[model samples]
Target: MVEQGKEQETKDFHPAPVWLDESYLEPLLRDLKKDPGLRITELEIKPATAKGDNYASVMTRVKILFLRSSAKIPEIEYYIVKTTYENDPFASDIFSKYQVSTTEMLMYEKVLPQLSALIEETRQPEKVFAATLHVDYEHDAIIFEDLAVSKHVLADRLIGFDLEHTRLALRKLAKMHAAAAVLNERKPGILTKFDHGIFNRYTKGFAPFFENLCDVAADFAATCPELGDHYARKLRELRKRVMEYSARVYDPQPDEFNTLVHGDFWVNNVMMRYGERKEPLDMILIDFQFCSWSSPAVDLHYFFNTSVQKPIRYEHQEELVQYYHTVLVETLKDLKFGGYTPTLRQFVLQLERGGFFAVTVALTCQAILTNDQTADADFNALMKDDERGRNFRKVLYHNKTLQENLKYMLPRFDRSGLLDVID
Candidate 1:
């Protein structure tokens, strides 16, 4: 969506609707209290996140000063309001095809509460998610308590996560998966509608986006002295099968461990709270718009390739996977899970089977996440095959850090047979 009332050169962002005001929020506020006399004294709205931090929704932070009773002091509340892009053809198409907004609303309205209750039932100390305040289905808006109030901050996407952050994230991820698996067993169809992940049979909206990014990767491979004709040709051919490759990798196999995965489990979606020593004390995952009922291995690959810092990204993967698998199995057993739990060998085998996913993320999502020139990047600039899109891709592919990451990763991917196209 293009920002209105600006020159062609200005960056685009989805603006909050004209209807968002004190009157529209009063009822939602009252729902939080039993006091019919609750009155909003003041309310302020501003852009919640910086450009390129999030893309699926327009994040607007609403700060409210309200009085629950005349006898009590007025209280302040901060909420991050998420709303969909309106009237834009691309937004309309993607939302309609995938029902992402609806799915996310369901997550907040139904799934997350149950997951939190499950953790509490087991008396586990793991922090699972932020508290959701409201879900406005009519307007496609979700109001969440701003985690910043609790001193939770997002790990640096450009710099990537260190071993501690990665370990904490994987541990929390395991708890979530374990709980969801048990929850699903109790309620068979709870996770049925969560199958529309980024790569699914329901839509091809990202096909062109991936194709163009792969092209950029191949072009970079050809230009870099270290990666000459051979890598370039491999990247080019791999570009053709991007969709099929991801589809196969995402497809769940029988007898393999599967549960609800945070499909976009990258740096942006993970928020961490640290201690005085800056050690990660807890991590909470956000953005359920891309959740899928698939092997947790896909999520593990996605997080490692796109979010972990390069120093440990490659060498320490086995350690991270083993730690996660151990936590997963322990949590499942603690929860009295009746289903088949995959052994470390089976889980590692599944991770290997889905190894191509890491390559896809490195070549596509990793480059986007690590690019610092994010102010001008948006859905239009990244998806459309126009001059603006091409220029944005140039900035993304040519990022110094991204180039270095590719240089270090391409050969490893080649060795893993991730670059080869299977007939």
Candidate 2:
């Protein structure tokens, strides 16, 4: 009976793996043959590097060996295959409940194709980084091109981004936002069709998590009170404000420039391929999981809050925000919409409200960024016990730097009289 109980416990607690079964391979291969009109002989699959907030699915590259009627073509070539497990928490449910996978598939099938065609028509020769979708329904899988070899460029670390790359990224973001703005204006029906219930769920659910993270920050501060006191106060205040902010629905104010933001716009999501001698390549934005119609300033605020180092925030805060705004205006001009130029006053209000939201996200994400990725541990192991000491140290270090930066930026918002405006 004891042995039986132990076995039952094991079965009950077992977690699903990131990758799906290899059994799904044959159907995908069959689908590829049918879709691409390629005569496939053999296919090999292997794990590929997972990127961009991906915790639920493992991506793999598939090597396809095929024969072509034309003799000039290569016989054995590889293509990337992305597959996801059906039982993943992020996967779709039977009742059409909230699921990131389901939402993404919906966006790809219904939303993205129309956007892609429109973008192509408007801006010829300057292609957006849109992934092709292939659903293998029999195997419950999907496959697409590996963006790594293509125009995509992932800036893994933010330690070495020069001004040029930063400028390029901002400009690309602007163009994307501008295109989205134009689309919303031209086709309000398309914008209205998206289910924003997921966003509401996120904003609502995030507050308590942020409060818990603040408690972690406070605990970290207690370890080195003298060194971390200022940051601890800042984090506590930020947590309180974020909780209040999250409760309010994000209604786009009239005359505000709304756009379909690449809601997750950190350095990692942008993939770039450089020219000869490391010149700037095209910026390919990926991971549309959180893409939504919101104030474009949200993207600008989020990118700066997450990507730019803490030290740079104090020194170049104004310059960075101004750069984003300038690019936004230029991109708007390109789209022939001069009426919606985002003012400094409006940007400051966004900073206050959007900055609160960003700080919460940053605090939650800090644990992932600072932890030892290779450690054989669960969430409790990393976040609880003596391991918490090491994690606390990392958080304290970042908290100090981030708090110092916020101290400098926050007062600017107050002085500009935008604090009251945002709320």
Candidate 3:
């Protein structure tokens, strides 16, 4: 069910693009043969998400009522459309520089379909991806059937995912990682262009943004009575090494298992369908804008830190990792992949080697995901170097919930030496 709050917020969102009318969509529908000779009788468009829900792209929900070629009655269909940021130049530049738009287009147009075909060959009952309807590079838009049409809804990001959801997510993630490995094996060098994830040499543009966030996190840690100055000092020192550390953590290790990491895997990107008893029946992953070729550990750390509930995130991590490993290895074996699949111990070592990513995510994107609903999420507003940006940073980092989470997490990170520089 669409939350009442979300519905009202959607109504209040910015207007849709001027060109996204019936004339532009009708031809696209015809190409997909949604209905031969169908005519769009009515068209509607609305912002697909509220502010802060997404930043890299503008999502608009498009709905059309059409008359079928042979039937007299009209039928309604819905689509979720993704286009590049219209007016946000900073976001546009960053996305372009990172090839985010082209990469996602390729994922939908090429990679994901092949991955799904491979999964189907395995006869797995689970569906792991959303169906892409069209990719209009001319308009810079990728359209997909709104998963809401199939009773899928996003889990609440603020409350985080419980044990059931977390395990389900990890299982699916492992399958994806396994499938990715087999896909790459079958078609070598297919994923070379995806080497750049969120942090790479091209990340100089975001250095201020990340550095400021680190400082904000440090200040927040300093104020916590339990953490005091020690952890704060550690975080501040870590700030200086942000780029270096990100480079090391993001680099694929030669001896470890690597797959196409869903560079931004968290609650919001994974949609779920539920049964009558409210148990999750199935799930699908969305948002390939940041997909990268990296260690599965990167995806593991990013998801656990940002999406899983604190109890499970802090306590049952071992169980979750083992469960994911089991599914991953089984899937790889079932697919008859020729590459070496890491043993559980090797996987654990990979996770340990990639442990700094947990700190990286927790200190940066986790706070963004957990921030109060009212926080300004405009990419330029958050990235600017003025007083306004400083205040916005305060709003993002000083949230009570985020503060509480940091209090719980910081000590663990310190003990693991994640907040310290490794020589």
The lDDT values for all models are: 0.84, 0.54, 0.83
Candidate 3 has what TM-score? 0.95
Q: Which candidate is the best by lDDT?
A: 1
Worst 10 residues of 1 by lDDT: 4-13
Backbone clash total for model 3 is 0
lDDT of 2 by residue, 154-254 (tens): 66543424566677777777667766676667767566344343234333433334466666655555555343565565556655565565333234546
Question: At residue 335, what lDDT does model 2 achieve?
Answer: 62
Residue range 1-423, candidate 3, lDDT tens digits = 579966666554655677899989898877776666988999988887777777677888898998878879988889999888866667778778777888898899899888887777664646899988888787678998899889999888898999999989988888888889899888888985687678766656677777889999989878878788998898899898887787677777667788888888999899999999999888899999888888887789889888988899879999989999999988888899888888899889889988888888888888788766554666776678898888888888767767877888888888887887777
**Clashing pairs in model 3, backbone N/Cα/C closer than 3 A:** none
Better candidate number, 1 or 3, judged by lDDT: 1
* Candidate 3 regions with alpha-carbon error over 4 angstroms: 1-14, 34-36
Per-candidate TM vs. native?
0.95, 0.72, 0.95
Off by over 4 Å in 2: 1-38, 50-53, 68-77, 83-98, 117-125, 135-142, 151-153, 158-160, 193-209, 222-234, 237-244, 247-251, 310-312, 337-341, 370-423
Clashing pairs in 1: none
